[model samples]
Target: MSTPVVLIHGMWCTGGDWKRVRDLLEPRGYRCHAPTLPAHEPTADQPLRVGDRSLREYRDFLEQYIREQDFRTPPILVGHSMGALLAQQLAARIPVFAAVLLTPAAPWGINAAGLANLAPFARVLGRWGFWNRPYKFSREAAAAYVYNGLSPERQKACYERMVHESGRVAYEIGLWWADWGKTTSVDADAVRCPVYVVSCGADRLTPAFAVRRVAGLYPQATHRHYPDRGHWVIDDEETEEMIHGICGWLRPLEQRAARGQQAPR
Candidate 1:
C-alpha cells in the first residue's frame, strides 16, 4: 500500500480544488487529504492578508495536522504553485517521506528572479480592465491558459465552470514572493527529504525555468519537464499519464520500505 499523501493548494484556492486529484490517487491505495488553509475559504469571516500569515504558520498547520491525525507514516506533501514552495519548507522542518512540487514558484530568498513581484500590478490593471480585458478569462484566454492541455470540448466545459479568484490574494501573493526570504521563502539546503518537481511547459503563471531552479536547489531532487501541459496539469487530458508517472516514481520507494531498506533520500 502507498503511504498517505497531503495536498496543498496555491493562493486563493481552497482544498476543494484538489477533489479530482484526490479521487484519482486514493483508488491506488494511497490515502489523500487536502487540508484547507486557515483563511482562504470563501466562507471565512475574515480573509488572511499578505503579512497576516507567514510560510512558517502554514507549515506549522500541516505539522499539527499530521501529528494529530496519526497518519501511517510521514506522508508525501504534494503542493501546487505557492503551496509547492510551502511544502518544501514543511519538509525541512518535519519528517516527511517525500515531496512533489508542481510548477513551483521560485523561493523568495533569491532576489534575481523578480517577476513575481509584479503580480500586484494585476490589481491596478484589473481596475482598468487590462488583465480582465485582453486576457480576461474569456473563451480565448481560457482556451490558451486554463484549458491549454485539455481537449477543445473539455476546455470549453471546464472553463464554463471556472470561477473568479480573489484579487486581494493575488496581490498578496505578489508581496509574499517579493518578500520571500525575509518572510515566505525556505532554505533549500535545509530540506533533506526526496523532492520531485513537475514543470508545466505552457504555464503562464509559473514557467518551467522557475521549476528547474528549484530542482537545482535540492540535494535529492528530480525534475521532469512536461512539454505540452499548462499550470492546471491535473485537468489536462494527459493527467492520467502524469499520475502514472508519479506513481511509478513513488512505487520503488514503497517497495524499498517493504524490504526494510531505508527510504530513498
Candidate 2:
C-alpha cells in the first residue's frame, strides 16, 4: 500500500482548508488525512478559548494523531504556515518518508520580520484580554495578508469560511509574551527525511525571503518559489499548477519508499 499523506493547515483554518488538495491527491491512489488541530474546530461541546493554547499543545495533538494511525511507513507530512512549524518539529523526532512545507513560518528563534505587514493587527498581542479569546481578522486584512492573488469575489468567499484563530498561537508566532522554552524548535540536522520547501513571493504573512531562509536551514531541502503566488497558493487560481508541482516532487520520494528504501531515521 502507498504511504498515507497528512495535510496540516495553518492558523485561521481547519482541516477543511485542505479539501482541495485532498481531492486532487486521493484520485491518484493516495490516502489523505487532514486533522483539525486543538481549538481549531469550533463545536458546541468544545468552545474555542485560544488564549490558553500553546505551540506545544498543537504539536502534541498532531503527534498523537499521527501515532494513532500506525502506518507501515511514516506518512508524508505536508504543512503550511504554522502547520509547517509543527511538521518541522515532528520530522526531527519521528521517521517520516518526506515533508513539504508551503510558505512555512520560521522556526522559534528565527526573526519573523517578513511578517511586518501584519503590523496593523499588532494591538492584539498587547491586549491581555485578547489572550484567551478567539481572534478573527477583518476581511480586508485577510485579503492583504493571504488572498491578495485571488479575485474580489473569491477572496470574500474565502474570508467567509475563516474561523477565529487561537490568540495564543498568534502571540506565540509573533513572539509576544510567549514561553521560549516551550515553543516549537527545529533541529535541521536531526531531520533526516527529504524535504521540499515551497515559497510564494507575494505571501505577506510568511514572505519568500523568510521561507527561503528556512529552506537554507535544511541542507538537503529542495526549494521552489512561485513569484506570482500569494500565501494561499494552494487555493489560488493557479492551484492546479501548485498541486502538479507538489505531485511532481513527491514522485521520486514515493518511488523510493515503494522500493523498500526506508526513510532516514
Candidate 3:
C-alpha cells in the first residue's frame, strides 16, 4: 500500500501550483492530493472574508480534510510557505507518515528579521485595512522576491499565474502573531514523524538562515540546502531535481513500512 501524499501550496498560490510535483509523484505510486486552501481558490464566484481568518482556521480546515479521508495508513504531508506552517501544525495534531517543508515560513518564536526581505510589502503592511483586503504582487516585484533564480522568461511566465494572498495570514506570519495558546507553534517534542526541510538560498521572502533555524528545531529532521535555488524551487529550473530528492527520501521510509517496521513517531 502506497502512502498518501498531500501537497499544500503557499500564500498567493493555489493547488494548481503543485501540478509539476504531483505529476511526477503520482506516476511513482504515490497517491498525490493538492487541495486548495479555503478562501484561496483563484476563481471563486464570491469574495472571502480572509481578513478574519487566522492560522488556526487554516489548520482546522486541513485537519478536517484529512480526517474525512481516513486513509489506511498515515498520509505524508508536504507543504510550501504558509502551507508549510500548516503542515507542521497538522503533523503535531495527527499521526503522519512524514512531512516535507520547502522554504517554509518561520513558526512562532522564530525571528525573521531583515528589512530587505520585507521591503517589497512596505506599502501595504502599514495600512489599517490591509488585512481586510486582498494583496497581489506586481510582476517585477514577484520576480525579485520569488523567482530570483529563474531566467527572465521563466519569471514572467510564473508571474502570470500568481494570485492574491490573504493579508491577515501574511501579517500573522510576518509578526509571529499566530501563537494562540501555542496552537501555531511547531512542537518538536510532539512531532515524532520524520521531517524533511529543504531551504533555498535565494528565497528572499523566507531566507535560508531563517529556514535553517526552523530545521534546527526538529532534532530528527533531515535538512537539505540549495544555495542557488530560489523560493519557488518546485517551479524553477531545478524542479525535477527537487522532486527526485523528495522521492529519494521517501523511498527508504516506504520500504521500512513495507517491511512491517514501525515508523518513528
Q: Per-model C-alpha lDDT, please?
A: 0.69, 0.81, 0.83
lDDT of 3 at 220: 78
Best candidate according to lDDT = 3
Give the TM-scores of the predictions, in the order they appear: 0.79, 0.92, 0.93
Best candidate, TM-score: 3
How many clashing residue pairs are found in candidate 2? Answer: 2
Tens digits of per-residue lDDT for model 1, 1-265: 5578999887545688787788789988888889976555554332323224545566688789877878767888899887887788788777788899987766764332335334434444456422222122557665664556777888777665544444433433444544434555677777887788899777766777767877888868888898878878755666778778888898898888789887777
Full-model lDDT, candidate 3? 0.83
* TM-score, candidate number 3: 0.93
Candidate 1 regions exceeding 4 Å error are 44-54, 110-121, 124-181
Tens digit of per-residue lDDT, candidate 3, span 1-265: 6669989888777889898898888888999888888877766532354545667788898999999889999999999988888999899889899999999988888887687688878876878877666777778889889878889998888787777777777677776654455545777778888999999877898888999998998887999999988888778788888889888988988888889997654
Q: Of the pair 2 and 3, which is ahead by lDDT? A: 3
Give me the overall lDDT of model 1.
0.69
Candidate 3 off by > 4 Å: 44-48, 177-183
lDDT of 3 at 67: 90
Query: In model 2, which runs have C-alpha deviations exceeding 4 angstroms?
Result: 44-47, 176-178, 262-265
Better of 1 and 3 by lDDT: 3
